[model samples]
Structures are given as structure tokens and as C-alpha cells.
Target: MIKIALFNHKGGVGKTTLTVNIADALADLEKSVLIVDADPQCNITSFYMDESRLEELLGESGEDGSDATVWSALKPVVEGRGDVGSITPWEMRKGIHLLPGDVLMSDYEEELPTAWTECFARRQRGYSVTTALSRLVNNNAESLEVDVVLYDVGPNVGALNRVVILDCDLFITPVAADLFSLRALSTVGRSVAKWIADWQTIRSLASPADRESIFEGLPTYGGYITSAFKVHTGRSAANPHADWEKKIAPRVRDRVVSVLGAVNPDLIPNFGGNKVGGVKHFHSLAPEAQKYGFAIGKLRGYVNPGHYATVDDARSTFAALAREIVRRAGI
Candidate 1:
């Protein structure tokens, strides 16, 4: 199964929105998809799951060993008990499941880095600590026949993200049309390069058999999606105005190629093809969909006819994005 992380070290770039909506679109296409909310904030989990149910799975009274979150599967490894045991993902639908997120996940930030150092010693704790998520997904994917695994991570270069990034097969970045996003391109690019190099160095010290114990190398740059490009007002539909894509698109192309090309020149992103469609601001439809747990595209007549166009726009845009991601990531 192909694993893709929808990440950006910048907030408000529609990262979780794209993860939730695009995965919904992929499920619409009959693909078995699993969304792992790696973000400690658990916004993606809240999007697809009921708050009460989520609380029961992560609350104090519910913090028993039976809790089924990404954090639950890592608790043993983080405590240096042993390898990760079977991960029981919460079923969301027929083909879509959720390995929910917990607020307590932040506790692993310090633990993972310490484990990384121990990994060079070929200790089982290090292997279990570093490979918990990968082992969970890999073990589940084969039996579940999952087509794709999508991850939603918070916007940061933290220790928890390091483990997630190192384990994935590919990463799909979501950025906005702004200077901050342009700057984050550098942050993500350099950090990923350093992580990959450091992991390789650690693996080099291990014997041949133990070398395979390291988590998968840093995920390849799958592509980028530029969100919040156009500012929508009541009259935007009547009179179209210039969007940020024109000014920011070239910079995105240049920065991605310059930073990531050093590793794989052929994988340099092409703006024309790699650019997923600019997602339209769905305004009220998004919050409404989240409230009712409906896919923005399929939000049935919960609103007036006037807002139908926006819902349709959100539906079509994410559907196109889902297809683009599948093609680019080769899922």
C-alpha cells in the first residue's frame, strides 16, 4: 500500500481539510482508504468521528489498554516494553477506517529522539519505537487490502513528525499562496534531507541484518497542492479577480525543484502537472459538513439552493485532487 502524508510546516493552509475531503473522494472511487490522524490536535479525527466517541476512546476514564488510537499502539514501544502489538483501527465505514489521534501524543516527542539514538545500538526498543507506525500500517495493509493510507500531521518540524516522515513512502505537501508557505518550503525541504541523511548514518553502524530495522527512508516528495489561492467574496463569482497562483506558482516550482532535486533530479515537481487544482474556499459548507460528518461534496439538502454552487465546487475540486494525488503518488 502507498502511504502519503499531507503535511506543511505552516498552519491555515487547509492541510486537514484536504486530508479529510480528498480521502472522502478516494473512498467514493471504491478505494479502501485509511486515514491516520498523526496530529496531536486530532482535528482530522474530529472531522470523521463523533466528539463523544473520540472522548470515550481517549478520555481519562477510557484510557484503558483497549483504547485504539495511534498513541495506544505506540505506548508499549515508548515505554520500552517491546515491539508494537496488533493495531485495531476503528472502522469508519465499509472501506474507510481511522487510527484515531490522541492529545497525549505530544508525550512521544522526547521519547522518539531518545529511541533514535538507541536504534544505532541495534536495541529492540529502538526498533520498536521507531517502527511502531510503519509496522502497524504494514501489518494491517496486507490483510485489509488497503489501497492507500493518508496521514494528517500538525504543522511543525517536531520529533513526532520525524518518525512519521521517515516511515512514509511519499509526502504530499499542502501550501497556501503566501510568503510564509514559500519559506516553509525551505524548512520542510532541509529538514527532510537532514532526517534521511541522519537515518542512513545511524543504519550504517548497524549490522546488515539490523540495518533493515530502521524505518523506511524519508518519504519522497510526491507533489504539492496550493490551497486558499483566491479570495472569495459575495461578488467574486460575478467578477473574477487575479489569484495568488500566478505569483506563487513559479516560486513553488523553483523551490521544490531546487531543494528536492539534489536527491532525485527526475522527481522535481512540475508546476503545470504536479499542481493539484486550487481548492475553492467552501465557506460555510466546510463547517456544516464537519458538523454533520458529511463529505462536502455529498452534503445533502442541509442548506438553501443558493449555497448549492459552493458545495458543488468543493466536491468537484477535491474529486479532481484525489485523482491527481493517486496518479502522482502511483497509489
Candidate 2:
């Protein structure tokens, strides 16, 4: 399976939305997809399930000691009980499944920084802790036999995101046309470059057996996607956010693509440019889709003439984006 992470250091750039919609689009293309909600916020979990069902799944362990949430799977490692355990992902639709997120997953963050430092010493436990999520994901993906795994991570450059990013095969950043999002590219770029270098150093220090405990290498930089930009009409044919989009593109190239390319040119994909695809603002349609737990393309029994064009537009945009992602990842 191809493991791809939707990540960005800047928050509110539509990472969760992109992840769900893209997974939906991929499923429409007949690919079995598994979405790992690595974010402690559990936004995607809420999006996929109702409150009662979500509470039941994430509340506590069952009589058989089974808990389907991500935290429960990693609880053993976080609490020093043992390595990561298996999780039962919730099937959302025909071809889409979700490994639901947990607020308790934030507890795992405390162990990561210490584990990272110990990695240079080749400590077995250190490697185990750092690779917990990756191992959990790989095991589940294999069991589910999915074609792709999309990880939805939080917006940060902390130890948690570091380990998650290292575990991915490739990562795509979802950016908004704004200054904060633009500046966040630099932080994302520098942090990822350092993580790759540090991981390489750890690998070099490891024995063959130690190397077998973790992913072979860090994730490649899959291109960025512009998201949540408003599409203006009426008085002017041009989008008001066009200028910001223009600014974001070159900055992503300079800050992300170039910086990581310097570390290892192989880290960058040769096919897609720095800007992979974009999703325009969903406006009122966003809440409607979210309320019904559907992708914009899959909304049912809708007859709003006003939203007809927007729905059609969303369907095509996400479909094209999903295809581009599959092609770039060589899946």
C-alpha cells in the first residue's frame, strides 16, 4: 500500500477536509482506502461518525479488551505495557475505512522526544517507541488489504508529527492562500530536512537488526495542494485569492521543494510541479456535506439549483486531484 500523509505546520489549511474528500474520490476510482486519523483532535472521526457511535468507540476498552481507536492500539507503547497492538478500523463506506483518532493519543507525544534522542544510541525500546504508529498502520493496512493509506496528522512540527512524517512514504501539504500558511512552509521544510538527516544518522548508527525495526527511510516530498481559496465572480472574472495563490506557489517551491531537494533530490517527485492541485472554498455547502457525513460529490437527495454547479465542480476537482496523487506516488 502507498502511505501518504496530509500535513502542514500551519493549522486550518483544510488538511482534514482534503483527506476525507480525497479518500472519497480515490474510493470512487475503485481503490480500497484506509484513512488513519493520527490527529489527536479527532476531527475526521467526528466527520465520519455520529457522536454516540464515536463515544462508544473511543470511550473505553470492551469486554474482550478491544478498542478500535488509534490511542487504544498505541496505549500499550505509551504506557510502557508493550509494543503497539492491532486496531479494528470502522468501515465508513464500501471502499473506505477509518482508524479513528483519539484525544488520548496526545499522551503518546510525551514519549517521542526522549525516544528520538535515544535512537542515536540504538536503543531497542527507542526504536520501538518511535516506530509504533508506523508499525500499527502497516499491520492494519496489510490486514485490511487496502490500496492506499492516507494519514491525517495535526498541524505542528513537534516530535509527534516528526515521527509521523518519517513513517509516511510521501507527504502532501494542504495550504491556504494566506501569509501564515506561506511562512509555515519554511518551518515545514526546515523541520523535515532535519528529520531526514537525523533519521539517516540513526540508520547509520544502527545494526542490521535495529534497522529492521523501523521504516527504511523518511517520506518523499509529494507536491503541495492549494486549498480553501475563495472563488470570486460577478463584477470581476478573476478570483480575489489569485494573488495569494501566486505568492504561495513560488514560496512553496523555494521553501519546501528546494530545501528538501538539497537534502536528497530523490525526495522530490519528478512528475508533478510544486503545486499539485487545489480546492476552492466550499461556502455553505461545506456544512451540509459535513452534517450528512458525505463528501461534496456524494451528497444525496440534494436538489438545490444554486449548489448544483458547486457540487459538480467539487466532484471533478477532487477526482482529478486523487488521480494526480496516485500517479505521482506511482501507486
- Specify the highest-TM-score model's number: 2
Candidate 2, 126-176: lDDT as tens digits: 898899999999998999999999999899999888988888889999888
Determine the backbone clash count of candidate 2.
0
Badly placed stretches (over 4 Å) of model 2 are 61-64, 229-240
Show model 1 residue runs off by greater than 4 Å.
60-64, 229-243, 266-272
- What is the per-residue lDDT of model 1 for residues 65-177, given as tens digits with 9 covering 90 to 100? 64477777767667766566566777777778888888877876668887888887877677667777777767777768899988889999988888888888788778776
Work out the TM-score per prediction: 0.89, 0.94
How big is the positional error of residue 140 in model 1, measured in Å on the Cα after superposition?
2.5
TM-score of 2: 0.94
Each model's total of backbone clashes: 0, 0
lDDT of each: 0.75, 0.86
